[model samples]
Target: MSRWRRLWSVPLLVLTLCVAGCAITVPSDPQGTLDRARGGELRAGASASGELVTVDGSDVGGSLAGIVEEFADSIDAKVVWTVGSEEDLVDGLEGGDLDLAIGGMTDATPWSQSVGVTRGYAGVPGARGPVVVLLPMGENAWQAAIEAYLDREVTR
Candidate 1:
């Protein structure tokens, strides 16, 4: 190739490579949980945990509940809550029956093996330590959405 042609091709190739590298890719969700819940119901499991999570019959409420509700609303989804024990909530998460779980779970939760936990946020009312929300395992996009919401709304 001619020297001029070779020099122009090299710069074009570098520019192409840089643009490709800088392109944004959506995070993956192995189960398509985020995609499904975007305009539909967000299945959420809740356990009774003091002021962090409260259960009254079929109704779920509390500080964490409010956050979950807001998160759902942000996605144009509604929360369909299932109130249960922690073990049941974990099972729900593992089985993909639930998109996320909340029950005043802390950073030190023992169910980390079966589900994904959000980053702990301190300053939660009535929480003894940093509070976390449980999510379906390997759902990166869903987890990222929730984490971003929490990061914006929750107090450090």
Candidate 2:
């Protein structure tokens, strides 16, 4: 091949690889545990009080709580519900006292670097459920995964 052709090929290949690598991986059992509220208990913390309570009363575990419970049942993952303020939930998740946390689409930088937030709820501002991921303090892969999952779930 011509030198110019080879040079172009290299750039094209790199571009393709980058694009492919950007694709997020959706977990196999993304909705299974939340779809059914199964036996495997997923300790989830949430922040619901006052007006937010009446608005998202059933969403005490956060908006995703209901869906998580549904999937948990399907996969035998029982979700142990924990109610608390948003700050408390974030603290709990960071402290490892809770497996997962539920909260508004506020700042999720501290808890999990890989945080995902969705918009579009029935009576809320945006999405129904948003998810966030906690990266290794300086990475985005984990966040990508959670975003992909949340993207899929939010649309559903």
Candidate 3:
């Protein structure tokens, strides 16, 4: 083989090995729940309009809000709602004003990976219901809680 080809092959083989060795193994239940008392309070933020209202009189647009509420209830945690634009809510979480936030806008954004969202729940209408869950970065406990909650609800 040519010297150039041989050199390229070595790097390619090393890259492939690294990728294979580093592959992440996801849990069977992607949404794993933590104990509520142990889980602590979960502060969630969301964008709202006058047209959308929660059971508590908080403004939360779309059916996504209802699902959020249900999940929060199931988890036995209070959802601290921050009603405003998507940017406002995201800013609130980033600024340490909130623990978690959920919105449709976020589901399509670059931040989705950090937020940890699940799309297209049944009976939500449209192509799929938009639901995004924004969790604190590096908070593995919260991630597990949210993931477990989602797996339970989505399965139902």
Candidate 4:
């Protein structure tokens, strides 16, 4: 190949590689849950599950509640809690009325088919098994964000 042709090809290859490397690949969120939650209200459903979550009138408190609040703060969002039974929370998640649900849910939760469940994290007081947080189905970005927060918190 000619010298000029070779020099031009090298620059072009480098540019192509740089562009490919810089490309962002965001996770899919069909319902835009994460987008809406950022710098906004995070609709969270809480079920009574012992120390993992406690509901007193409109107030929610417990280990899991603290974790959820911290996670919401990390994203510049405020949590709007809804207290209900496990079934009701799952229904809210399925219907897109809640961004997340936490109530000492475990890996063995039967509502997995209807919602997105985070990977179970251990260490919650009084939890029967690894505890999980549930989210709306197919909100991959939202699920990932919550899971990432849980991963960091659970490890600490």
**Highest-scoring model, lDDT:** 1
The TM-score between candidate 3 and the true structure equals: 0.55
Q: Is candidate 1 or candidate 4 better by lDDT?
A: 1
Q: Would you give me the overall lDDT of model 2?
A: 0.47
Instruction: List runs of model 3 lying over 4 Å from the truth.
Output: 1-41, 49-57, 113-130
lDDT of 3 at 24: 53
Clashing pairs in 3: 31-147, 31-148, 32-148
Best by the TM-score measure? 1
Candidate 3, residue 19: the lDDT equals 89
For residues 1-156, could you state the per-residue lDDT of candidate 3 as single tens digits?
A: 999999899899999998887755433222322343233555667655222333345745456566666767776766667776666766765565666665554246677554444432343422143445665455556666666666666631
What is the C-alpha lDDT profile of model 1 across 1-156, one tens digit per residue? 999998899899999998897754667898999999999999999999999898999999988898899999999999999989999999999998999999878999999988999999886677788999999998999999999998898876
Per-prediction TM-score, please? Answer: 0.84, 0.45, 0.55, 0.82
- Candidate 1 ranges beyond 4 A from true positions: 1-26
Candidate closer to the true structure by lDDT (higher is better), 2 or 3: 3
The digit string of per-residue lDDT tens for model 4 on 1-156 reads: 999998899899999998897755668799899999999999999998888898889999999998999999999999999999989999999888999999978888898988888888886666678999998998989988988888887842
The per-prediction CA RMSD against the true structure, in angstroms, equals: 2.5, 7.5, 7.8, 3.7
lDDT (10s digit) by residue, model 2, range 50-114 = 33232244445334456545545545666676777666766665554555555453333444443
Q: How many backbone clashes are present in model 4?
A: 0
lDDT (0-100) at residue 22 of candidate 3?
73
